[model samples]
Target: MDLSDLKRLGHRSGTGGWGLGGLHETGLEEVRPVGVGGPWAASGTRASDAGEPGNSTAIAALIRDALSADQVVVREVSALTGGAIHAHHAIDLRAEGGTVPGDSAWVIRFPADPSFRIGHPPDVEAAVMRRAARVGVPVPEVLKTGQARAPGSVAMDRPYLIMRRVVGRAVASELVGLGTADGVRVGRRAGEVLGRLHGIAPDAGVVDGLIPPPEDPAGARLANLSRALDATGAVEPGLEWVLAWLTRNRPAPVPPRLVHGDFRSGNLMIDGGSGKARLVAVLDWEFARWSDPHEDLGWLSAPCWRYGRRDRPVGGFADWASFEAGYRAAGGVAIEPARLRFWQVLALLNWAIIALGQAGRFRRDRPETLDLGLTGWRLPELLFEMLRATAPEARAEGADAPPPASDAVVLPAPVPGVEDLLHAVRRALSNGLPAGPEEMGLLINAIGIAERATAAGGMARAGADWGDRARSIRRDGIPAGRSAAHHGRLLAETRARLTLANPRYLIALGLD
Candidate 1:
């Protein structure tokens, strides 16, 4: 298998700077050893300077002062990967006279960049998590939340949240690799947790400050994506078709409930022991809001979250049947097939939109992160994933013949074979080059992009073909012959490009 194939089994890329080779390591805000927590100490800064370890020392001191401790010692400060949108670190704290009473591991989360803060502010997020935890959702205990710079904390310039760090890994690759039975166990547990989360009453005040639960949840979501797409100024006909399809097949309104907007594999934490795996925590509540419960269900079951274990719909680890059983057992309302499909489609589109934003961050913001650029390279595959999900029904409705297998198209070539150069660099990074997981993920991702570029000529041709067919349908009428033809061609092109982009996905879906 090539690098792309290997990457399919890897964790989602981290938002960190990248390089082909040479030394690259994710800097900690402080180099506090795991077991030691003491007074403030400075450390090196990263390129962004936003996640400097020195700031971690300040945070440790801040926590110390907040807790009314004589002195706060940061035992360990380690940057935690996987929060692509936020910069975070796990700080093992030792407080002398803090209100909390003793030393413990805490997580401090701040924006990846100073200019952009996600959903709610730190205080708001802490409040939401506290409410969710009270309602029986497995979440970390929020210790403190504020924007005020604590005494002795000098590097902090924005709001931050300090929460008890829960154990277990959030890495998808590890969770997906759990033994089948163990994986299913984890999935069922996650389903139960989500069901309980949805069971929280709307009057619980969790949605305060966020937009009120929209009367038309699906429409509201689609409109949000439409706005995001508009902002991107990048045209995607497949995405446009998805928008139209969503409008045409809108599901009946369901009462809005608490939805974990980004509920999926990577966001969940799993504990494994004695040959079994269990859901430890349901995290990343930045996107949590009042929405249809099925929205959470669909997002959890989306193909993208499954990694390569596509057979297990609930996650990459358990089937929908098991997941649904757990959900029902936990008092979650029955999931409607149509509504589930609707949200699942929306989940794909929403993820694609987020990926676009990631790419845009790299292109527009010029962050030192290379993962953003690699994320941009995934647009075609992401759109095609949406098409694959939406096009099959139209095929049954009498669309035209499937387009021919993607044919080779010649394109400009770089001096050294691009794929080879990428592979070599990736090898260097993988083989003893000092780089953190985040940087390595980016390098691996770059290699995948380079490999996929080999098929760019074919993918571009297929996209143009589909775009023409799509425009023809748009110009004609809604239910005209051209619509079916367009759908069929769209499916064919999506499958062809998807085959090149991620054949593992097709095989996982039994399409291979």
Candidate 2:
């Protein structure tokens, strides 16, 4: 199954080194070798291997078994973006040695979950891929597919997938909001790209809820909610109820089109130095299908990809007008605002549930899981704020200041600083203040306020970051990699605050 000679083919074509041109410099070393198992790591070290040569050889055999392709090679695997859970790597192979006419750079994606869920066949991913491609969302042409090679687990675990490597850069985590002109360009381009995707003719639809969940609806609900709370520890109040309302009151579909259900910043990639800034590939087609085109539109506007820009609805590109314009330019029909708004609310609600799952995973000693869990707390609160602002009047009582209810929880002075409530809460958590509902409520309020402050800071922060990111992009080009990653962090933090303020004042009606 070894395909070492595959290196001689064309793997060395302009590979290696930062940004797209010279906008920024990614200090990354190690230009990943093709036909190897790992791309982020050195040439031959497999992320799945533990310094065991024999393990990789066995993996090669497994690849051959899974795919109809002639040969496969496992070199090494490297963790991508936050080095969080999922690991992405390069797999090089050829049809008949180097002599074969056909070839591909296989991407091996695996979960780094310490305890992976089980009870799924190896072909589930393959099946998802096949189904998705049929409806027009792009998937790596599957030469082969697989589940985790659990040697000693009681429950079969750690499902992994291998497919043709996508031709563009990994544009997920970094592509959230437009920060630099490059990001803005990328962000706006992403808008145009997704608009086109929403144009695909209707074929089918999906609602699997990506990560595995308990069989029952409640379990799934709890699982997703826990995930969000654990990751962010915040909530977007009232969004859940509104989404439920929208789900029930859906105004039927305007039209059906191929929808990449999970279309988000991290899922799509753009070719940088190649110019054009056109989306080189549509990815993560596991959620792809034909359905209400507005679903994709809503996902585009989801809080999950806010990249901290609550003001610009579509990945911080501009307003809804720009997004809608771009969509129309890309050939999608103008969708009903009411229907599309329902999906927008629906996207945040979906994310809110998932945030809880993240919290559950990390609340234990899982250090890696902690950040993911932290995200859970943020989105729920943010989404809650969105719903609150959208329907501020929903909470009936006199609109003007009435006597504060004794039960209306608010924290007494514990922190010395006026604005550093988060620091105070952190100190409390560290000192074992035992976070109960009361303490948690105060923490949430404090976070909401801080979030507002940060978002107010974005108008200023954006100016500062533009120079840094632009330098990186210029040094490298649009594929500014880590430069974009840095920007992504800033925006996420800022948008986190914007959601807290419920700025648009839309949630005011909910008070009634």
* Most accurate candidate by lDDT: 1
Report the C-alpha lDDT of model 2 over 220-261, residue by residue, as the tens digit: 333343333323322222333343344344554344555565
- lDDT for each residue of candidate 1 in 1-512, tens digit (9 for 90 to 100): 11221122122233342111101122111111111111111122134432355666576665776678887777767665443345666677777775776777777776555454446676666667777787678888877877745342333476777777777766555666678788668767787888888887677455566567778888877777766655554555567778888877888777777777667766677776747678877777766778889888887787666654557777676777777777888889788898888888887776666555545555444444454444444454566667766764546732574664456521111112234336445555556763667556555545554566575652332346544544543344245446666666556655565555445555645668
Q: Give the TM-score of candidate 2.
A: 0.56
Regions more than 4 Å wrong, model 2: 1-51, 65-87, 93-95, 98-104, 110-138, 147-160, 176-249, 253-258, 273-276, 317-326, 360-369, 379-381, 392-512
TM-score of candidate 1 to 2 decimals: 0.77
Candidate with the greatest TM-score versus the true structure: 1
lDDT value for model 2: 0.43
Give me the runs in candidate 1 sitting further than 4 Å from their true place: 1-57, 70-73, 150-154, 204-207, 360-370, 392-399, 402-478, 503-512
- In order of appearance, the predictions have TM-scores of 0.77, 0.56
